[model samples]
Target: MSKLLVNEKEIVVPGETLATGMDNLPGNGTYRDGENIIASRLGLVQLEGRAIKLIPLAGRYIPKTGDTIICKVIDVSINGWRLDTNSPYSAMMSLKDATFDFIARGADLTQYYDLGDYAVGKIINVTSQKLVDVTMKGPGLRKLKGGRVVEVASNKVPRIIGKAGSMVSMIKDATGCNITVGQNGLVWIEGTPENEFLAIQTIRKIENESHLSGLTDKIKAYLEKAKKK
Candidate 1:
């Protein structure tokens, strides 16, 4: 006899009578009243077969046990390459983990990945202390080249990426740019001079106006105007 309503993607609220039944649950911005559930943020709605649930759109970038990310090789040693994960904590890529074979101890490890080389890889593990271990033995996870890196607020990343990459894809498709979003809020965009500028503008808009509701619609409108211009 209990009733639950889904207002947005990140939370679920109960109706008037149901609130009394759901008093124990925490508030995640999605709340319920007698009439309907209210959405606290903009996100995709998830239907749980028999129920409605909301998944938050914004969150901190906690390096998980198997998250794939783009990183920069900053240092090298007999052990491996030191990486900057866009977080306070850095990670290591053992030489054995670099690639197959015969890598001389130190004939200039830079030859292998050099300082400032960008690589996409997976987080093999993370210690409770936040020590991150990463590897590159996967598809489409390797060094990146010829692009400029930009950072956006971590909380705004989902809006910037959109559902199923539709938002990002539109920017890429219209501007003719190649872009990649790192979970750490780092975005890489490379393309013709004109396209790069357009992509940058789009991402900046997403960051600045993240608080506004109906962002997807706004973005579509913006892109349409741009197309006409």
Candidate 2:
């Protein structure tokens, strides 16, 4: 039948040989070089011992029950505020959804959350219609300011932040840029524009090559080279 190829992570290279052939193929990430296939992402690998290929045990994002996320305030109405969830679906934060305190009538609520403000919010509810409701009444939830926001694919966010904030902390240490990564793929970088730019570029590089192994060391070397340049 077919053979499998070994790679550090699952990747879509330019070709498939007879030893790597599959009669019917799955989408991206799953590849066959004959019957021997490999995983493309950093997660548990699932294999089907035939013409099929490997599947990642984990997916990038599937809205869950209690995911804390960082989001931007886009618009506000008498009823609630609109939030950019960084995905195709947007989120809502009703005035009533926030704190339990009584709000003044016709008060400048924008003072609480102006457009372009970022906040660490939580998913209070997700409807069957994909309507997401969020709240900022929890710990570590507040507005963001004076930073540059960047968008990346949802799948790359984990790589940018790394395990337990290790990757982001390292980048901040190297570039002297403060970073806040949102679960929905929104990143805020604050510092001198030069440092911010460098940090963003570095994070992007990490994201693009995250499927490869030993990425932490590679990123360290890249920062060093960039500094030398």
Candidate 3:
């Protein structure tokens, strides 16, 4: 018979036994160890149809191609802009990738993206050397204005997003905030001062309590209270 060694949604540490027996399979964040499934990192346990996985509690963002991310403009160059991608490696958005508009060779580059600007962009490529090339030509990729940004554990981004985007949608509805969640953990919140704080608090709560069950209801209830206040 299949035996569960831990409760669903339980927070587990590295090397903790998650289950026993051969009836279950190890998925992400877990590994099989002599008839038992063990956690490979500190994360929340997720059990699904004989498959066990983990949602990591803390980790940095590893740049991946095709990931939509928030970036900060750090420097401008004759050819492109250097961006801080919240990762160990920096990213570049070449003039061709910056926009469709024709930019003369001698044109001022800062006119396109000034220093200290925030933008929503997509990762077009990541080289073996960990060099990241990003683009702003796609839809919804542009300089973000008038919003505050916050960072969270990058690996926890999936949890903050929740299933089918239910978690983020709930937060938006609750605080009436325009929130853009980057897969890299840079979140932009634009709304009234009151709503921005509410969104920030709610996101931090999710980041802290992601391993708990019934988190959707908890966030919803918290937002309801914030609305009433």
Task: Using TM-score, give the best candidate's number.
Answer: 3
Question: Which pairs, if any, clash in model 3?
Answer: none
The whole-model lDDT of each prediction reads: 0.72, 0.72, 0.91
The number of residue pairs in model 2 that clash at the backbone is 14
Candidate 2 wrong stretches, greater than 4 Å: 1-44, 47-62, 99-102
Q: Would you give me the overall lDDT of model 2?
A: 0.72
Q: What is the lDDT of residue 194 in candidate 1?
A: 73
lDDT score of residue 170 within candidate 2:
90
Which runs of model 3 end up more than 4 angstroms from their true locations?
1-54
Candidate 1 residue lDDT tens string, 1-229: 3444333343333222212234224244345554444455544456454344455565556676776777898887667899988777888887767766577745667777888998777889899999888887777677788978888876677778888988899888888888888777788889988778878998999899976888888887887788688
- Poorest 10 consecutive residues by lDDT, candidate 1: 11-20
Comparing 2 with 3 on TM-score, the higher-scoring candidate is 3
lDDT tens digits, residue span 12-107, model 2: 333432134554454445444445443344343333433334334344454544777778789988878998887667799999776567789897
Show model 1 residue runs off by greater than 4 Å: 1-60, 100-107, 211-213
Model 2: worst 10 consecutive residues (lDDT sum): 10-19
